[model samples]
Target: MRLVFGLVLIIGVGLAGFAVFMAKDYIGAYQAQLDAERAARANAVPTVEVFVVNRGLRYGEQLTEADIRPVRWPENAIPDGTFRALAEIFPDGEKKFRTVLRAMEKDEALMQVKVTKPGADAGVSSRLSAGMRAFAIKVDVSSGVSGFLRPGDRVDVYWTGRGASELGGGTSGVTKLILPGVQLIAVDQIADSDQSAPTIARTVTVEVTPRQVAALAQAQATGNLSLSLVGAKDDTVSDAVEVDQSEFTGETVAKEKEVCTVRTRRGAEIIETQIACPE
Candidate 1:
């Protein structure tokens, strides 16, 4: 009887120990959750309702009530030019004439530069800034950087035409640089800011000054134009870059001469003669 009693006492003690261990574990988990909640409350910041995009938006797209949504943004973290009130984004709950000037992602804040004014169209003329002109150039697979060119990239213009050297003798076909560091405004008809993929476009428009427009127009009319993409960090100045067949093929270039000389013999005496050479 004593042996059986001893066995029962040991089993009870073991079960009691396991129950205490389980209770301690449960208490620890509950305390951890409570501490987390307290921290969240202490670090909370003030927030305000602001207008944001409900879905991805493209350039030249008209704005509507369904395209925007209100979200709680931190008061101190609000971006510049963002609209805080719904009326500011769309007066009287209407956006009938506004359009997107640039593409925006979902939940992005609405900014002044990202949209056009009331009754403004998103055409090419609207995209140009003050004092900037748009010039379109014909492009092919070889001249346009093989469909890798896109809007927002800077490029250098090259003219592949025949022209004479400064000495003015015979004309040699040469390729020369016309413009450098020009910003591309659009590819074909797409001016969206979100386009990052390679596209094959027949025509590309660039932003230039009034003088640049004249120079580009003359170069295009006289010769074939080609575009070269410029790197974001490249600072090398491109000017007077020219190459001819002789230079490219490493052949000897003939110098332009105004006069030619010939050796003649008269009565066993050597005589030198000068003659005019045709250009």
Candidate 2:
């Protein structure tokens, strides 16, 4: 009876030990599965190649592909084809990373001009080739008129001057007339891409042929230049009628009329009255 009891006890302990072993094995499998799930979750986030570089570069600074290195992926990533981010990604170099740009143009002077650099006085993409006529007139476009004005905003030129009144009161007045087909050679003042509350300048320089430049200079010396936004599709220059009325005296019409005076001996007399008008 003792041997029978001992055998039964051994059998019971053996079964308990097997159950504990199985439980441990199951727990190990579960832990391994959890670890794999965490690893996959970590890798699921997409990582892109970003460039980190030093800054404060001149227009023609030499930068190799090695000068720029890949950085940690950022959330609000820059788009694939924008040139604006080049300077932002590579600020003054001490505070943040910068990205340098290479010139596609062969001209050294043109290459040295940092088109991407901001602030007023940045050269317009409307380049001035040697002997090409350009006008040095000021243009005032409301910064609020559009989100921003880049080197390439198409604009229509308008003039505010004294001219014969389109309204026929036999009078003249200061009038704002659309110059019709004048093209914006360049946006004379470009607000810095990195600044707030961009400013307006007295004159925005424009590129014109020699004749146009002459006409523009005359206009600037005499009349006011205004710009109307034409948007992207309307950059074409149409036929324009330009006149020189710089020496306007007042806002009235120039009239020559005959006045009849009945007197004892006089029959009729004609008199001329000059009316100055605004354009």
TM-scores for the candidates: 0.64, 0.39
Off by over 4 Å in 1: 1-50, 69-81, 84-96, 166-168, 232-240, 256-279
Which residue window of length 10 is worst by lDDT in model 1?
89-98
Model 2 clashing-pair count:
31
**Alpha-carbon shift of residue 87 in model 1 (angstroms):** 6.8
- Write model 2 residue lDDT over 15-75, tens digit each, in one string: 9999999999999999999999999988776655454443434423444333444544544
Give the count of colliding residue pairs in each prediction.
Answer: 0, 31
Q: Which sections of candidate 2 miss by over 4 Å?
A: 1-43, 54-67, 72-135, 138-158, 169-203, 206-222, 226-279
| Worst 10-residue lDDT window, candidate 2 | 104-113
Best by TM-score: 1
Which residue pairs does candidate 1 place in steric collision? none
TM-score of 2: 0.39
lDDT of each: 0.85, 0.49
lDDT of 1: 0.85
